[model samples]
Structure formats: C-alpha cells, structure tokens
Target: MKRNLSSFAHPVCATLAVGALAVLSGCSSSAPLFLSDGRATTLVQCPVGSDSCSQQASASCGGAYDVVRQSSASGTLSLIYACRAK
Candidate 1:
C-alpha cells in the first residue's frame, strides 16, 4: 500500500512560514525605547537597590514640580542609561 505525505508537509510549511513572519516583524517593528511627557525626564541606568535613576530623573525634570518614579518596566531592563529633560 502507498500513502500520501503531502498533507503533513503542508502544515509544517505553514507553521514555519508563520514563525518566520513573526520573527521578521519583531525585528522590523520600530518604536522608541524611551519617551517622556513634558513633565518628566528620561533616564537610562540601573536603579538597583536605590533610587538614583529616579532622583536624577526628578532633577532633570526642568522644575516641573512633580514626584517621579521609574516606570515599572525600568527595572526589568538590562541596560545603562542617560538622562534627558522634557
């Protein structure tokens, strides 16, 4: 008896194509890693066990008179940072 294998191949190819498209889209998507409203400053640094980054962000806030804390996502990042006034 003979059996056909083309049906299995079709699903495998489709899955691979979808995965490739996802990877390519992830690579090509362009968005800023940092952005701030006019009231805050941007800081890129470790605030590990301290509030250094947030403090600097506050100081760089151009006297906006608001309390600042690092965004929740801040600590999850593994990168050194700089400051920018808004």
Candidate 2:
C-alpha cells in the first residue's frame, strides 16, 4: 500500500532549517571585524554628561577608525575603535 509522505516532510524540513539557522547564527562573531589590524587598538571613554558620548568617541579616533563597540558604566561611556588602511 502507498503511504502519504507530505505530513512527515514538512516537520522534518522545518526542524532542519531551524537547526541550520541556529548553528549559523552561533558561528557569527559578536563583534564584527572593522580593520585589517586583526585587533582593536584604540579605546576612548566619554563622560555621561554629554548627550553625544558615542559620537564624541567616534570622532576621537581622528576620523581614521570606525567605532566597533560602545558601552557605559560608572557614568562613563567607552568605545572600541578600529582603523582600516586606505
């Protein structure tokens, strides 16, 4: 007797797709690469008094690097910047 395969097909495919997505997401880096230097070299800290702390940090890199991360603690904002060669 012939049996229907559609019901089993959908759930299995959905399960496999979800699993693949999960694995791929986990493989992604939390902090993406911003420079060819292979590491973040410049760090800047901005006081919380300024509304543009993040902007200030980005500018502090002397227009050469891109800000890759920003964090705040103890009323101070911190940034990690990476410079890429032209």
Candidate 3:
C-alpha cells in the first residue's frame, strides 16, 4: 500500500520549521531592544510631581537608567551600556 506524505512525514521536522520561522520573524520585529553599545547608561528616575503623573512617568523609565517605562520618548542621547544590567 502507498503511504501518504503528510502522514508519513515527521511531525517534529514540521514543528521545528515553524518554530525556526517564528524566531526569525521575531528577530525582524520593529519593537525595541533592551540595551545598546554596552555602556553604563543612567535611566533618570524623575521625582514624582504634583500632577500625579510623576509616579507614572518615573514608573515608565523604571528599569536601568536607559530602560523605557513610558510611551513617549525624548531627544536621543549617547549611551555607554553593557549587553544588559544598567
């Protein structure tokens, strides 16, 4: 009896192909990278203000000095940061 390719083909091989494609697509995503050039950058933790927005704003930039917490970003600045860990 002849075998069906779909049924005979290895499921693991198909799964690996799909996973590889997903990883490739993720690398091409236009989101954001956590760090740059590998330097010690300061993520300014601005003081909480009267408007109650200060806490929110600072929370946005909460991670290491360069980490982003908020949606809106300001002027670009040079940063000397390590692969990670600010």
Candidate 4:
C-alpha cells in the first residue's frame, strides 16, 4: 500500500518555518547585554552611514556612551556601545 507522504511533509515544513522565525526573533540587535561594570550595553544596527545608531545610543544612555566597537557589514552599520555614567 502506498502512503501519502505529501500531507506529512506539509506539517513538518510548516513547523520548521515557524521554529526558524521564532528563533530569529530573539536574535534582534535591540536586546541589551550587561557589561562587567553593570553598565547596559547593546548592539545598535541601522542603515549604513545613518545617524540612527548614534541617536539610539544617546537615547539609550540618556546622554552619552562609549563605543565598544563599530563595524559595517552587508550594507548595515553596527555599533556596540555601553552607557556612560551620569
């Protein structure tokens, strides 16, 4: 007897797609990581050459911040910053 494998494949494919999306959602750059000094740090991603990253850093720190690192990749600008003291 031949079984219908197509029907089984649909559910498996859908489950995998949903799982991938869920995992990707958590990979957002907006999520902040804590520094050893208890300062809040995060990777800010924005359009290449845009001031959005700096703006976000300032807002996140409420004024100034230190750039731990900066790089541009795949037409995206990224800045790793830690909030500065008040």
Q: Number of backbone collisions per candidate, in order?
A: 1, 0, 9, 0
Alpha-carbon TM-score of each model against the true structure: 0.36, 0.39, 0.27, 0.59
Tens digits of per-residue lDDT for model 2, 1-86: 67599878999999999999999999996665445667555666778667464565456555565667778899997877676445
2 or 3: which has the higher TM-score?
2
Clash pairs of candidate 4? none
Q: After superposition, how far is residue 65 of candidate 2 from its true place, in Å?
A: 2.0
Ranking by lDDT: 4, 2, 1, 3
Q: Name the Cα RMSD for model 1.
A: 7.0
State, as a TM-score between 0 and 1, how close model 2 is to the true structure. Answer: 0.39
lDDT of 1 by residue, 5-83 (tens): 9868999999999999999999894643443553322334654566665555456553443433434454542232334
Q: State the C-alpha lDDT per candidate.
A: 0.53, 0.70, 0.46, 0.90
Q: Model 2: how far is 56 from its true place, Å? A: 6.8
Candidate 1 has an lDDT of 0.53
Q: State the lDDT of candidate 4 residue by residue for 1-86, as single tens digits.
A: 77699979989999999999999999886646788888877888999979999999999888989998899999999999998877
**lDDT tens per residue, model 3, 1-86:** 88788775788688999999999998893633444464433333232333234433344446333333433235333222222343
Candidate 2 stretches with Cα past 4 Å from truth are: 1-40, 49-62
The stretch of ten residues in a row with the least summed lDDT in candidate 1 is: 77-86
